[model samples]
Target: MKTHPAAHEPGHSSAPLTGFSQCHLGILSQLQAFEELPALQAAAAQAQTIATHTLALFHDAVYEHHADEERELFPAVLRSARRGEEADFAEAMVRRLTAEHRHIEALWKKLEPAVKAVAKARPVELDLGAVEELVRNYAAHARFEEEHFLPLAETVLRRNGNHMEALGLSLHLRHTPQPIGHI
Candidate 1:
């Protein structure tokens, strides 16, 4: 895959969100692999490994993707767009994306306990339903982001040009560890 300049830089705080959105979609694709029958049996063992790596990519991409929008991108565009309805429209889109993230987090919390129980059993047959739920929620969240959020960001946020690259680098610098969501 070709690398976006903003995605690779550590100090660029102006990159448009498409850099992070595409990065997030990549992580989502890897999460789907855990749902496959061949991979499901190993999901528990792979949980820590996948979760650690995914969280790293996710923090730099998804978490900051929203933050950049709420803090910088949306505000930047909202200034020039219509003062009332268009502003509200951008805010509404941000709220929707934020809500989806919360929804996915909620499901992840529920799924964690179930995953823990299976982890205690190790190689034993785990609850496929629990795993399915997490995967489903994450997949849906990704679709929502791609279909709704990215379009608005591309249209509204990309107008600033090269700044997005700087923003992407700054976000990449903030990556950190995340706890596994309880089943």
Candidate 2:
């Protein structure tokens, strides 16, 4: 994998945030694309491409992105926050965001089989209402983290370079491939 120069540097990486933006935008774009099409038959090249893209996104990147935030970013913020109000706020934010992740994921679980069929260019039973609900929930979740949690995390981590470095490195390492274990 190509590594960014700042991937392990303090205050230099916003990989998690960037990941969130890309995944959400891609998901929303694919869902909206469906709305524009009269029907996404397996026969249409564009429909097939979009369906495949949507399936891969929801199946993989979204889950990994959520895991990255929960495992790396949230802990870093919590570690950096001062005791009392700052710590409490950080904890609360993490709890809310984590819950959001579960809720969104549950929505996806219900919707994934349809997405899978689309990706395979098989007969699809895509439900427009479920798609719309996922779109709305993801948008709101992204907004909350962007407007509230991210700024707070920045404030908490900015005071300590060590904390930022650790967070950055953890994020980088999470994406890095490891050597194969014994078969």
Candidate 3:
């Protein structure tokens, strides 16, 4: 698949933004695989393997990515907007994205246990419809962030001249693993 031009640009600051886009692409691929694969009832072992890998991808990357945006990026954008010139528009975008995050989290809760069971090779009735809904919602959410939110954030952060560093730092810290005893 062709990567976005922004993804190849030479800049450490853009790494997290590009990574987010790449992550979404990966997630969409996984979702498409899930949607296309035969039901778990038909091929238990293969389905179980796919389920386990997909669940791991979500837990390790997607969930943490969302948390980075919520805990670091969004707040930084809001603060820059509030203090800078784009207060109202940026605030509205942040609110919309945050609400979308909650919706995505709720759908994830509904799907997690079933995925976990399937991953364990246990016989559980999977809600394919809910899975499809989540895929649809997440695709839309990612699109919105990629096309709208991230650009807005970049603009606001750049205009403020300091928030971008903080955004980058927060993203780095979120993705970095802390020592087990450090909490």
Candidate 4:
């Protein structure tokens, strides 16, 4: 797939979100796999392998993605909007999206213990419902961001002083060899 020319640079032409978009694909696929896990299996070494990797992904990529959006992307978006109505609109979108993130995280928390047990090659009563819910909600959240928020962000950032460069710089600095997601 030919990515956007700026995909290699943080925040350049939605590069931050471009990477996020890819992560979303992985997350969804993993969630689907989790949904299909043999719930009653006594011992499945392969399940343990998948579970370990899934736990790593949730802890690393998904958590960092939330922090980046909350600390960087959403704020940059709010800054990119004009005062009054535009700002209000951006705030509403951010609120909804942030809420979705929290809800997804909550769903993950519910599933974490069971997944952890599976990771250790132990029997687990994995809540397939929770896994399915996470998959469903996350899918909707990603779709909304891709379909609505990203385009709106690009337009607003481009319109308001061409702030994409500043956002890019901010994101690049955040990911440099340092404590990430630290104030």
How well is each residue in 71-166 modelled by candidate 1, as lDDT tens digits? 665555555445577668877776776687777667656655545455454434446786688678778867977796567666665666655554
Two-way TM-score contest, 1 vs 2, winner: 2
CA-lDDT, candidates in order: 0.64, 0.88, 0.84, 0.88
TM-score of 1: 0.49
Q: Considering only N, C-alpha and C atoms within 3 Å, which residue pairs clash in candidate 3?
A: none
- Candidate 4 lDDT, 40-131, residue by residue in tens: 35348778888999899899899899999999999999987889988898899999999998999999998999999989877779988888
For 1-183, candidate 3 gives per-residue lDDT tens digits of 998886677773776778999999999999998986667456887888889987987888788877888788888888887554577778888788888888988998898999999899887998989999999999999999999888888877898666898788878877678888754
Off by over 4 Å in 3: 1-42, 82-85, 179-183
Q: What 10-residue stretch in candidate 1 is worst by lDDT?
A: 117-126
Top-scoring candidate (TM-score): 2
Give the Cα error of residue 63 in candidate 1, in Å: 6.4
Worst 10 residues of 2 by lDDT: 38-47
- Candidate 2 structure quality by residue, lDDT tens digits, 110-143: 9888877776677777899999999999999999
Cα distance off (Å), candidate 2, residue 19: 64
TM-score of each: 0.49, 0.73, 0.68, 0.71
Task: For each of the candidates, give the backbone clash count.
Answer: 21, 0, 0, 0
How does candidate 4 fare on TM-score? Answer: 0.71
What C-alpha RMSD separates each model from the true structure?
Answer: 27.8, 26.9, 25.8, 26.6
